[model samples]
Target chain A: MSARVFINEVAPRDGFQIERDFVPTAAKIALIDDLSPLGFAKIEATSFTSPKAIPNLADAAEVMTGIQRQPGVDYVALIPNEKGVERALACGTDELNFVMSASDSHGRANLRMTANQSLERFEHMVALADGHNVFINASISTAFGCPFEGEVRPERVLEIVARAQARGIQGVTLCDTTGMANPRQVASLCAEALSRYPDMALTLHLHNTRGMGLANAFAGYEVGVMRFDAALGGLGGCPFAPGASGNVCTEDLVHMFEQMGVHTGVDLERLLGVAEQLPTLVGHDVPGQVVKAGTSQRRYPLPDAIG
Target chain B: MSARVFINEVAPRDGFQIERDFVPTAAKIALIDDLSPLGFAKIEATSFTSPKAIPNLADAAEVMTGIQRQPGVDYVALIPNEKGVERALACGTDELNFVMSASDSHGRANLRMTANQSLERFEHMVALADGHNVFINASISTAFGCPFEGEVRPERVLEIVARAQARGIQGVTLCDTTGMANPRQVASLCAEALSRYPDMALTLHLHNTRGMGLANAFAGYEVGVMRFDAALGGLGGCPFAPGASGNVCTEDLVHMFEQMGVHTGVDLERLLGVAEQLPTLVGHDVPGQVVKAGTSQRRYPLPDAIG
Candidate 1:
C-alpha cells in the first residue's frame, strides 16, 4: 500500500452547512485562507446550493471568490445540480463535486431527486462545466448503508459508480453518510472499487457517529485508497440522519497517519493551532479528540509530588 | 487471524477510580450485576488499593461481595501489592491483575514503585495467589509510551513481559496508559509479544485520549492478540497523565467486532441497554459514541416531509 495519503478539508462545506448559526462571510473567508497554506490536497470551500435549502452557506460565492488561493491546492465546491455548477463556475471553482445518494429515499429526502434523476442532472452539469477547466467529481452519499432504507448492497453502489463514470466524472467519493461503515465492509468495498475503477480518483468520506471514523479510514488506507475527506475539528454531519455527528476530524486523522509513519504532508503544529479555534468558531464543543488531548509525541512534566 | 475476541470490562475499577465523587456502594454493585450476564469473559470489578488513594472505589470489598456472581464469568480485581492481593483473594476474586508501568517515571508517579520494584512486588503477589484457584495477569502500563517519559522502547516492554512470565504471571496486558500508541507501533509490538510469549494470555489495554483506541485495538487484533481490556461507556483515565481521558469503549469495540463478522460473544443489545444508563450513573455525559449515536445496525425514520 502507498505511504502517502491525500486529505480534503471539508469543514467549510459539509460542516458549515449544518451549523445552527450562520458563520459570518468574512470568518468563512478567513478560515479558508488560514487552511490554504496547510498542505491540504483540496478544500471543499462551500456548497452552491439554494439559500432556502441551506442558509448556513448562503455566502458561498463570497467565500469562494474572497479567499486567497494557495498554489498546489484545489478549491472544490459541492454542486447539487446545473444551477449549482453554474454558480460554482462563475466563482472559478477548481473542482465541482456533484452530490447524490446511492439510496433513492435519501436522494429524495436530501437532494429532492432520485439516483437516475441526479445522474441526468449530472450530464447537464458536466456540459455546463465543459470549458471552465474544472475537475468534475461525484460524491455518492449512503454508499456504505442508508438510514431510512437499510443495507445498500455493494452491487447498488457499484452500479452508481458505473453510472457516474459513464457521465464523465473524474473522481468519486464513497461517503459513509451516517457513519454506518465498518472496517471489514470498508476494506471489502474499497478494495473492490479500486479493482473495478482503477482509473477513478477514489476518496473515503467518513463520519465518527459510531466512533469508527478513524478505524474505517485506516481500513480504507490499508486497501490502497489514498484520498480522504475530513472536517476541521470533526465538524459537519448529516442532519437527515438522526444522531449523526461530526465528520472524521482533519487534525486527528493527520496525527494518526503521521504517527504511523505515513506521509500526510501536513504541518501538525499549524493544523492544531487552527483546530484550537474551532469551538469558539462554532459556539459549541466539537467531537475532535486530538485538539483536546495533544498528539502522541506530547510530553507532560513529572508530578510535583514525585521526588 | 482468529475471529473470536475476549473483552474484559474494566469500568468499575478503571472508570470509577477516577470519578470526582464516590459512586454509592449499592450503585456499584448494581452496575456489576447488570454487566455479569452480558457474556463478558472477565470484569475488573474493583481495585484493592488504599481508601485514601482511590476514594471513589473505597467500597471495593462491598461491591465484590454484593454482586451476584454469574457462572462462566471471571471477576477480576486490580492488585497493587501483597495486601491488595490478600484482599482480592479474601473477596474470592477470580483473577488478580497486578498493575505496573513499563516506564520508571510513571510507575513512581502512579504506583509509588518503579518497574523493577513492581515486578518484585508481583512475585510475592503471585505467590499469595498460588493456593487460590485464580488467574494471574500483569498489566504493564505505559507499554506503548509514557506521558512523563515518552517513547517506552519495545525491548523494555518485552523485558518486563519476560520478567512477569518468570514470576508465574500467566497473563499480560500491554497498556497504552495515555493513548500514545499508533497502529503501526501497536502491530509491531503486539506481534513481537505474541511471538515471544506464545503461552501467555496477552491482552491489549488502550485509552482513547488521542482517538486511536479502536484503531490500535484493530491493529492488535490483526496480529492475533484476541483479548482486550475496555471500559463501559468509555470511562477511565490516568490522573497522572494530563489530558488523558476514557479507555476504549466496551460497547463500541464490541459493535465494531460484531459488524466485521468477528464473534465477541457479547449480547450487544443488552449491553447497549446497560450503556444507556451510564450518563445518569456517572452524573455527566460520557465520551462513548455508540451509546449516544446508536450502532451501525440502527435505522432512523425518513424525514416526514419526504413523501
Candidate 2:
C-alpha cells in the first residue's frame, strides 16, 4: 500500500439534516451534483431514515432520484431497516449503509433493539443487499465512546466487527458517535481491527466533538487507513447529542491530506468553492474554518497583497 | 516516561499581542495572579517586544513585576532581540524566549530579518542571558510549514535546534507559527531532534489553524515530547502569518492528557474555570470549546439536562 486513501462525502445527507431549516430535496441534489465532479469515491447521498426521526432529511428519496451522477462516484444511502432498504433499493441505491449502535442504551433509543438483535437484523439486511448486488457497510455507531455508556470497550467493537464480517458485509465504519474519541483510542481500535481482520476493510466516520476528527483521521492514516468519511464545511451532528459537533470538514481534511502529499484524488479548490455555496443555501454560518481562513499555505506577497 | 507533560501557558504574551485591544496591564497581572495556583510549571507572562510594533502590551514591565508569582512558577517573557532581554531582566524575569522564523520570507515579514540573521542573533542573545541567570528558550517559528514557503524541511529545523544547542539555551520550541503542522511532521522532527540532542528538552508549539494542533501535540507526545505550548481558551495567533490561528487550547490539551492517564499536573475543571473567565475578560468568545461544552467526559443525561 503506497498510502492511498478514499474519501467519502456525506454533506448532502448528514450535513443537510443538521440544519435548522428544511433544505429542499432539489437543493440537496444540486449540492451533491456540484460535489459529484470532485474525486470523492463515495458520496452518501441521503438516508432512508424515518422523517419523524430526522425531519430535516424528509425528502431523502427525491435527493436520491434527482442527483446527476458522475461516472466514477458511488452514491450511497443510509437505510435503517427492511422498509428503508426496500425504499433505497427501489430507488436504485448502488451502496447501502446499515447502522446500529454498539451500546445497548443507544441501540434501544436509536433502533429500538439490543445489540444482539441489531446484529440479527443486520444479517437480514445483508442478505437483502446480497440479492440486489448492493454493497452493505455496517456502521457501528458510538463504537469509540457512547454518550450513555461513557466508555465503550474495544471487545465490544471487535465483537461487532467480527459479526459484521461474519455477515459478509462489504466494510465496517467505526463512528465516534458523540465525538468522544481521541487519537489514542482511534489508533488503537482501527489498528486492532485492521490487524486482526486482514480481509475486512475499515473506515472511520468521525465527528469533531472534542476537535479530534482530523487528528484521528491522520492517526488512522498512519496505521494504513485510507478510507474516511467527511462532510462539506463540517456539516452534520448527532442531533441527539447536544453540544456535540459536525463531522470532519471535507474541504479541511482534503486540504490537510493533499498538502501532506497524501493522494485523496479530491480537488481542493473545487471543494472550497462547493463549501462557500452552503452558507447561503442553509441560511446560517456553517462551522468550517478552512473555507473562512483559506488554506494556511495560501498567501500573497504583502507587497502584491497591498498592490 | 509516563507522559507527565508540562503546558507552558503563552496566552498573556502570545495571545495578547495579536489581540487588538490593550488588555490593561492590571488585567494581565491579575490573569497571572489568578493562574499562579493552577500547577503550571511556566507561564509566559509578557513580551518585551518593541511596544511600537505591538502597542497592546506596552506595559510589559508592569505586568512582569506585578504578577503574584507562586514560589516555583517560572515567569517567562518573549525577547525579540537584546533590547527586549535587557528590559525583561530588569523587570525580574526568570526565563526568556527568543523567536526567529525558519523560512527567510516569513522571517522578513515577521521579525524584519532573514533566517541566518535571526539564528545568528539568537547565539548572541543566549550569551547575554548566560550570566544574567535567565533561562533562554529559542523558539523557531514556522518550523512545520511556512506561510511563504509551502513546506519546511525537518533538516532545517534540526539546524536551528543545533544552533540553540551550540548556544547552550535551555531548550528549543518548534512553533507552528501559522498552525500548518501535521502529526507525521511533528513526530519526525521531535524524534530526530531528541535523538541528536538527548539532553535538550523539546517543546511543540502548535496552532489549531488546520485543526490538528492537539493531534500534533499527541504526535510529539508519542515520540517522547512532554513540554507543550497551549493558550488558555485557545487565545493566540502570530500576527505576522496571514491566516494564522490560535494555539492549542489549554483546557482541551489538559483534558486529553488527563484522560489518557498522561499526567499534565494541571487541573481540568480548574483550567476550564480559567477559560470561562476569558470571554468576560477578552470580550469575545475565546476558542476553547470545553468552556462552552464542558469536558469531553462531562455527558449530560437528558433528564438532568432538560431542566
Clashing pairs in 2: none
Q: Over the true interface residues, superposed, what is the Cα RMSD of model 2?
A: 3.2
Best by DockQ: 1
Which 10 residues in a row give candidate 1 chain B its minimum summed lDDT?
B237-246
Candidate 2 residues A27-114, lDDT tens each? 8888888999989999999999999978987898888888888988988998888878888998888789888999887777778877
| Stretch of 10 with least lDDT, candidate 1 chain A | A237-246
Best TM-score goes to which candidate? 1
Error of 2 at B6 (Å): 1.3
Using lDDT as the measure, the top candidate is 1
